[model samples]
Target: MSSAQCNKSAITLKGSSEIVCEYLDFGINSILFQRGIYPPESFKTAENYGLTILMSQDKEIKEFLSVTLSQLKDWLTQKVVNKVALIITNVASLEVMERWDFNIEYDGDQSQGDKQVSDKPLKQIRNEIRDVLKQVASSVAYLPLLDCLCSFDIQIYTKDDVNLPQEWAETEAANIKNAQCVKMRSFSTNIHKVNTMVTYKNED
Candidate 1:
């Protein structure tokens, strides 16, 4: 089958799970870069999803993401994770200034261990990523300027039946005060789908 045709059909569960994690890696890095949470010198440009994307080079940041994304991918493969939020906080006060929420949805009727092909193609998934990346790049037009240093945290929500990892802890939802939320684009594999929304400290 042609590349286009392949992307048009649903991919296996394992295949879709990997793509989801890859998207999270790129998405988080994109947010940090666009929001100026990290210094520009710490990142290098790379190509992904037909766009020039920035990947972090800072050793600490890279290690952190590697560990976090690994856990997220494993949870995703088990279909136990429900939500993943990227929380950006003020460096001084440690207050949550912005949040990038990625919510996952699955067919309730489908049980675990189903490695069925996704109904959506890979090509279509890239298109959705393109739209989101464009918005992230232009976010400075609306998002507040960060005049001070900032840090970020990844918060994951999972089903009650999940067995928590030794390092993972449960915490209250990171709510942004006086939030102004903007719903963004989404894409899916037949087995799993993700919807995105961003909430920022509204300056209103």
Candidate 2:
């Protein structure tokens, strides 16, 4: 490949990592808005994926997601972490209400080397991510409403051998009792593919 051609097509590990994190940022915000975990007033609409997306405006929530995804991007670039889960719980009862799991896998031959690069076009990947976000937005039609006050927490599932950060302590998996799951669309950047699913407490 010529120098210019390679430059146009190459997608580095760090670049793909940033893409995944950005998707999570928008995806999480979409869920929070649709599921009514936070008041609608706390979120503002922004354009993404050729559609309007509501992102959280709360300062603390924004900072939490920013820092968490920064560390996660590093793990993603290293191919150490496999899953990121967003757990929503009832604030009053402390009962697990809903869980959104974003399963990650290194895609194609890119996983074979330390320097990950893919020829997949960025526009195509963004379209795929848009489809996933659309599914999340329409999820409210089938998913149950959050009747009580709720809060959210993010959990990262990493490989057993990876060293933990001083501030990052391990916690038990936030499993929901009598859970019913709904599988959502998956998106890929050729270098990485993320499969999304939501498991919720079954009221029936």
Candidate 3:
């Protein structure tokens, strides 16, 4: 995980509509155009080869990924491009806790004066969030993208969980499978300032 504060200027540019034009002119190998607004510098290091775009609102990248799975169904019949790399910006960690309605409770004898706390381990909660996102990214979007492109290698670049739930580390290993598609991993970085480079692989 590469964590750093990004430049504000880059983030502003990324959110602007001009980002599409800017990236097109960037002449990079590939573009993981996260429709969500964030920093632009992160993509500066992408290989100058083929350019691919992924678009969705900043708040809805996960939802968009879920919906895109079915959209790429036809591409499966065409050439096999089995690998894809995902670049996400503005990952809302709190949303996970909100979705799961996770909370802590305390129950103990007041007279005895003992602390009996029951709380979802932060790590466990974070893992649940990671698993959910990973499932959505790999099983839903990346898999479909591979099926459409006719390849199988996929990689992801994302932000490191600050104050994350413990289960996050283990969850990542469970959601990915090696078959028509293999080797899915995620890189972590902070998108609050400058942009970073992410690598994605697909095999058929």
The numbered model that scores best in lDDT is: 2
TM-scores of all models?
0.90, 0.96, 0.18
> Where does model 1 exceed 4 Å of error?
1-10, 107-113
Candidate 1 structure quality by residue, lDDT tens digits, 1-204: 687876656477777788888888888898889888888989999899889989899899989889998888888878888999999889899888999999998743375466556666578877887887777777778888878789999999999988887988888888888999988888776677888888999877
Candidate 2 per-residue C-alpha lDDT over 33-104 given as tens digits, one digit per residue, 9 for 90 to 100: 999988899999999889899999999999999999999999999899899999999999999999999999
Order of models, best TM-score first: 2, 1, 3
TM-score of predicted structure 3: 0.18
Superposed Cα RMSD, model 2: 1.3
Candidate 1: give the clashing pairs. Answer: 7-121, 7-122, 10-117, 10-118, 10-119, 11-118
Candidate 2: Cα lDDT at 11: 88
Q: Top TM-score: which candidate number? A: 2
Tens-place lDDT digits, model 3, residues 163-200:
32342221231122222333322211111111222222
